[model samples]
Target: MAKVRRYSSPYLSDIAGGKVVVSCQRCGLERRYDSAAMIERAGDVSLPELRIMIARAEGCPRADNVYRDRCELGYDPECWNGTRPKPTDVP
Candidate 1:
């Protein structure tokens, strides 16, 4: 398995919905994947692979989208530290 990332649906908590933005590596293309909208298939495919599958289905075989963002947790820019803040941290 690849490095587990907090932003991917496979590793994120189900209770707190999150969103993932996929930016293509070949041609500049961005797609948002929300926790609520993702359909999990019965297989061993990882989230990154799934992302590549999505990219391929969309007519791009490069399937190398590196731009991913974790939007539901400590990523808020309004945090006092000018960075993502934890739940207990001041925002």
Candidate 2:
């Protein structure tokens, strides 16, 4: 049998029942992405991959950091600091 590798982050398709938003905590950059459209476009990319993609797309200086100071880009609320609710989650 071939060895299988598992990733700790969720694939884009694994996110469910909520709006998908990517944001940068340090610079206050943010974007709301349609999850279904994203899944169709990227074909189930892992959230970590998507985070880097977003950071690069937005020209974040820390996009390529591979050490302790990683880019702050992440899926909203859940992956990021959860103090604020995702915009869609607000009534």
Candidate 3:
């Protein structure tokens, strides 16, 4: 089987203070990302650019809500591998 990929949205806005909303095309999951944490991880890169890079790195295409129908049927290019790290596994 082919490997599944994951992706995130590039356009980020402040839904609330200190937290930014992020959309995952692969899983259709909307989650909040810590802006400060992201800035620290992507020093020198703009937020939008960093979002795009992160999405592509995870194998998701930069698209809009126009593809929502397709994404519902699981046609998303970015799919998760269904794995999670346990507390004991954390370094």
Q: Which candidate tops TM-score? A: 2
Q: How far is candidate 3 from the true structure (C-alpha RMSD, Å)?
A: 14.0
Candidate 3's residue-wise lDDT over 38-57, tens digit each? 56665435445555555554
Best by lDDT, which number? Answer: 2
Which runs of model 2 end up more than 4 angstroms from their true locations? 1-6, 77-91
Candidate 2 residue-wise lDDT, 1-91, digit = tens = 9533367667776664445688777999878776778777776787888888878888988999999788878766463334567666789
The TM-score between candidate 3 and the true structure equals 0.37
Instruction: Compare candidates 1 and 3 on lDDT and give the better one.
Output: 1
Which regions in candidate 1 have their CA more than 4 angstroms from the true location?
A: 1-16, 40-45, 64-91
lDDT of 1 by residue, 1-91 (tens): 7555544454323312455445544465655554445544313344555556666666764445455532211112223232443344556
How many clashes does each candidate structure show, in the order listed? 0, 0, 1
lDDT of 1 at 24: 48
Please give each candidate's TM-score.
0.43, 0.68, 0.37
Q: Assess candidate 1 and give its lDDT.
A: 0.45
lDDT of each: 0.45, 0.73, 0.42
